[model samples]
Target: MAIFTIDDVEKTFKSGDVSEKILKGVDLALNEGEITALVGPSGSGKSTILTIAAGLQKATGGQVLFEGKDMTQMSQEEIRKIRSSEFGFVFQSSHLVPFLTVEDQLLLMLDVAETKLNKKQQKQEVSKVLDLVGMSHRKDAYPSSLSGGEKQRVAIARAIIHQPKMLFADEPTASLDSKRSKEVMEIIRNLTKTLKITTLMVTHDEEMLPYADRIVMMKDGLIE
Candidate 1:
């Protein structure tokens, strides 16, 4: 079965009497262990698709299936459980806790979201992920002390710490310089391959297309 399947999904926002249709009859799928890039111009419904798939928002009409289980009908609590245990997210900003150390940020995620790893196992698991993202040495440092690239690396480490089956990244490199952006992309691609993590990233950078196994383009409310 596919890791994720979106079948004829639609989303519309109601503003008083008129409704704005954002996504119109969309269908998409993701296989295990592959990196897919969702590319598009602004207002192309890229983030909307990701948010719906992540269960952050309900589709107006249609189904979202993960491992063949429909999330559309699941309770909010159930969907939150699924998101915490099975998926990870990275955004344009690192979004690390200002007061927590890098290690603490990662450990907190495993504590609240994942159940498969115990305290000892969690530490070991997080260690390996930090190393994979080349943030091992800075694990003890606080977010305020790290550079932009370092903070991003730590964010990536935290996202994968629990070993989520799927990852969603939206404009992950939007805040980095050209050189730093390239480095971050390389690390993401390598780590995704090593862990066999299925990833869908929405990005505007055409230079990073070669790293993705497949590029899916969206325009307005449809995939083009």
Candidate 2:
């Protein structure tokens, strides 16, 4: 089943008297337990579409349906709640707290999501996710001390710490070297499949395509 659907989605930006349409009535769906890669050139609106679907920005028109609910119609507070509880994000940068240890990062995510787990349970959950991402050995290390690949692993662990139903990744491997990028992609693929989380990722790297179950190409603001 499709866990997320984007129908006739549009986005536009205006500056002074000039206006630009970034997304023009694009449509796509992300199925359960699969990774869908959105690939396009610099101006193709792939990242715009990902952000819109993640509720980070509002679409100019059309529906973003998650589990049969229209995200576009949700109030700001409603969307915020969903973003915290149901959606996970991994950006090109790891974006980890400079001072927080690897283990603390996942704990922070659970706190932000207001997860129901008690203190002890939360720690166990964090450990489990860290193990899943193969970063458990570095749980006590700070982000500053981690390698590029290790930091990305920690970031992925934090993103899934709460078991979100959907994961949105924007150029997740852009900063890493080719080998690290492959490792990161492999982790994402294995976790999404094992945890049955639907994933929509925006990436310009053609090397990442093989890891995705399906690839959606966009051009000139529309899927092509």
Candidate 3:
């Protein structure tokens, strides 16, 4: 079943008297436990659509549905709550805390999401996710000491630590080398399958297409 859907979504930006339309009537549906990749050249609105569906930005027109509820209609507080709990994000950079240990990053996410797990349970959950991302050995290491791939692995661990129902990855592999990129994608794909988390990702790397279960091509603010 589709856990998330974006219907006829449109986004327009205005500065002074100038206006630009980033997304124009785009539609998409992401099924449970599947990875949907949005691919296109720069300025194609791929990232805009991802951000809109993730509730990070407002859509000028149309609906963004999460489990049949229209996200566009939700209040800012409601959206923030959902963004903190049900959804997870991985950006182009690992975006980890340079001073925080790997384990602390996941701990912070659990705290932010207000997960039901107690301190001990939260630590255990962190361990499990770290193992999944192959970063268990580096749990106590700070981000600054880790390699790029290790940092990304910890970032993935942090993203999934809350066991969110959906994950949004924006150019997740953009900062990695080819080998590291493939490895990172493997972890993401395996986690989505094993945890049944629906994922929508924006990636410019054509080589990464194989990791996605569905591919949506966009151009000039519309799906093509």
lDDT of each: 0.89, 0.94, 0.94
Alpha carbon lDDT at 17, candidate 1: 100
Clashes of each: 0, 0, 0
Q: Candidate 1 lDDT (Cα, whole model)?
A: 0.89
Tens-place lDDT per residue, model 3, 183-208, is 99999999989999999999999999
Candidate 1: misplaced stretches above 4 Å? none
lDDT of 3 at 146: 95
Tens digits of per-residue lDDT, candidate 2, 82-200, equal 99999999999999999999999999999999999999999999989998888889999999999989999998988888889999999999999999999999999999899898999
Off by over 4 Å in 3: none
Query: Candidate 2 — what's its lDDT?
Result: 0.94
Using all chains and alpha carbons, the TM-scores for the candidates as numbered come to 0.96, 0.98, 0.98
Query: Which residue pairs clash within candidate 3?
Result: none
* Candidate 2 clash pair list: none
Model 3: residue 168 alpha-carbon error in angstroms? 0.4
**Lowest lDDT block of 10, candidate 2:** 127-136
